[model samples]
Target: MDNLTYGIIGCGMMGQEHLRNIALIKGARVAAIYEPDAGMRAASANACAALGLGEPRKAGSITELLSVSAVNVLLIASPNYLHLEQLEEIARIRPLPILVEKPLFTDPADAPRLAALRAAYPAPIWVAMEYRYMPPVTRLIEEAEAATGGVKMLTIREHRFPFLEKVGDWNRFNRNSGGTLVEKCCHFFDLMRHILQSDPVRVMASGGQANNHLDEAYGGEVPDIWDNAYVIIDFASGARAMLELCMFAEGARYQEEISAVGPKGKIECLVPGPGRFWPAHLGEPPVPQVIVSPRDPKGPVMVEIPVDPQLLAAGDHNGSTYYQHARFAKAAMGAAPIEVALSDGWWACVMGMAAQQSAATGQAVRIADLPCAAGLL
Candidate 1:
């Protein structure tokens, strides 16, 4: 197909961000959208028109959207629980490329079926791990790959605002989101694997649902999602990754702080959230300076990761959504390979599930012991 027409499955925050980014990509457009919420559907159409992309046809149901002849590609950005079912539905219509959001599945129960589906599917299925396309994070990964002793240890920390309220409050339960680690921290896990270039062996974690949404009752049910977690992962190459996530800690200097340490040097990046004013006098506003420090503390160096001024101002992971779409478009057009593969997405979910299980049982969980780990491996 010379021109690609995308049908977005969900019109939520991520879905709308996709619409905004797709407008910036040439030869691609959101031809249709499937959002059940009437308000959100109308809002999505308005957003498209506002961006001069013209109003996208709003499909009244999933079946209607999938049947649209104008849509050549499908972008699945729906809630966690609906992903598997939607994937199954999309599979019936074969040869159409799909791009699914992170945390491949809410649970590992469907791993076997998904593996089978992948083996038989005709078109490419890519998962959206936007962090891999982030400029600073990419630079850090490149430097780590070039390090002398390889990557020894890595840490991904995010202390930011609480989870946003979804359309149905589905994010308040573990069954829906696969806990906070799977829902929100999968991106970090995928990044860890990409930087270290290894698979995880074991996971140990400690966390619980406290001080966030547990006290509130919506529809007479208390929230059961964890508000904080500290996870440690051991990879096969003796490299380790530590993730410290706190959902309630507000007003952080940076939304995400990532650092990778190797034998030769360490690379660290701090990305400020949108609208965060670090300093007016600073030459560059949002693009943070990367710090590279060698084993000897006396010698230190700094690097700048350039980002488009307009993209940095846009929402969704510091303009990563746009770059991700660019890459996806290229891959779909047979110009480049799929940057984030389905196996990597599944491994990320396995790591998250193991962490959640370990936190619940107060014991370390091995990745090889997880459900369907054999099939996945």
Candidate 2:
């Protein structure tokens, strides 16, 4: 397909963002959009109008959207719970290029289904793990070889808005969305895995509904998902990772840190976003803090790396993820290599699932038994 036709499911904030970005990607065009909400659908259509991408249609329900004649690429951005239904249908449409939003499946048990879908579809099915393609994160990973001797440990802290209150979607349900740990923290989990260059052998987690509930004043059932969680992961490479996730904070810090204790030295860098909370994902921020030190210091020698404002171009609102999808569109048109395949999304889901299992059982969930372990176990 020369000019790939794209169809988007769901018209929530994320779906609208996909539509907005479809233009930014050269080889693809938004063909149809599916949203059950009338007002939201109209809004997305209006937004697409500005780009003259044309009105998005409901495509006569999910079945037609998958089997439709005009659509080539399908972007599923619907609720966390409904992903499987659409994915299953798409699976029947074998070998079609599909771009699914993050957290491939809410449940690890669904990994088999995902495999079946991919086997059935077998085309370049991709998951939008956008952070992998972001200039800052990408550059940091690129330098991993030159910057480290051996990774000993990594840590990620995500203090985000209370998703239940902010997004108000089915993601609020643990069962529906694979809980916050997997559904939301998939990016961080994958990042941790990427940095360590290893798979988690064990995960220990503890969490409960620390916050994010409809107040008694409002009198409603709150989404029964954890607002705060601490997950500890031990990788096969002898590297351990500690992940902290809290959704109830007044200010959110998307702070990400990677520290590796290698033979030569320890490489540590902190991406300098709002350590407290900043909604600013758009503009250029100062380079994250980086420090390299000898593995065994003589006395107290120090190296303070200078600030780098040009470490990466400006980024915003997971829009860094937008470029990932852009590349997917390009790959659809045979322009660029697809970086994130379906298995990548599955690995993230498996990581999240292990965390969820660890959280529920109050034990160290082993990743050895995952169906899609790639024989790492």
Candidate 3:
């Protein structure tokens, strides 16, 4: 664990981002990769070369990648549906510390499989909740208690562009990407719990495909992923949290705006979308900000939280991916504890699934009542 070497399962858009960030870390290097697509493999090589890192060996399969002696750590950035199976495959063959992307499992029936994996997996498995590490979001989480004097309510709003086309258009369908809520909003759900310091008891939502991807047909079927949603979650601590999501509002200055309020005051953080998407004509993108409003002061103070330009250039999520990988490397090297654990990932997905169910049935969904969550509960 002195020098971290990564074995990548997928090398698509997100995987390439991970590669760039991995190159930023001092002791981390990608030794082997198992990307099925030839174009992505070439792109990953080019990215590594641009970053001045040695070329990573290309493996045909996950098993082959795991067999490499230099690969002591694993990164699973594959398709949403393939995550669970690939984890299981790794566990069966050779278990290594893993940093897996969000929306851990797609189908409800797979909960038992996850439970089994949780029981058997020996190495650290950190779920990639990159938003939690964003500079503004991190500042908000750190200062929420003192600013709010015990938060009574929390709200997270995300207004951004539609999902980009993935390899083979897999992201356009619900089945492949675990629906919009679980696929896209799990990060918000995880944030709700992290900010509230409590688990959700009930979820009520109303969302549908109002805009974007309505007419596009793939394999003779239109995409069913939702583009907008309003979700209200009742936490076990009696605190209420809300999430507002719109996938067609890329024109908005900030992609994510989070607010927490209590009897004392309110604190809010504004995070812009990826800098690469910002129009060059606009001069420069908006910097991340955290505003604190004190009830007694009668004034609000806003602080600009600028990210490292190199980190921003590495990946999206406001340089959070790099921070997350830095911490994940520490956890993998036994220097620090896993911040986002398996249970955290499970709760995040469960909350999203509950929201999706509520929206579909037009009824509030209780977390305790979901059979899929029975194992976790």
User: Which candidate gets the maximum lDDT versus the true structure?
Assistant: 3
TM-scores, each model vs. reference:
0.95, 0.84, 0.99
Q: Give residue 373's error in model 1 in angstroms.
A: 1.4
TM-score of 2: 0.84
Q: Estimate, for each residue in 1-377, the C-alpha lDDT of model 2 and write its tens digit.
A: 87777777887877776776676666566667778877777887787777667665666577766665778888888877678678887776544677788877776656667777666665677777876665545655665555556667666766656763323456666877888788888888888777787877888998778767644222255567777899998988888988887776635233555555555666555554432244457454444455555646533233333322221212334346456766887777677777777667777888888787778888887788656554334
By TM-score, highest first, what's the ranking? 3, 1, 2
Q: lDDT tens string, model 1, 89-133? A: 888764588889987888778788678777887787889999887
Where model 1 places Cα greater than 4 Å from the true spot, the runs are: 276-286
Model 3 residue 301 CA deviation (Å) reads: 0.8
Give me the displacement of residue 246 in model 2, in angstroms.
1.9
TM-score of the candidate numbered 1? 0.95
- Span of 10 residues, lowest total lDDT, candidate 1: 275-284
Which pairs, if any, clash in model 1? none
Error of 3 at 280 (Å): 1.7
After superposition, candidate 3 runs with Cα above 4 Å error: none
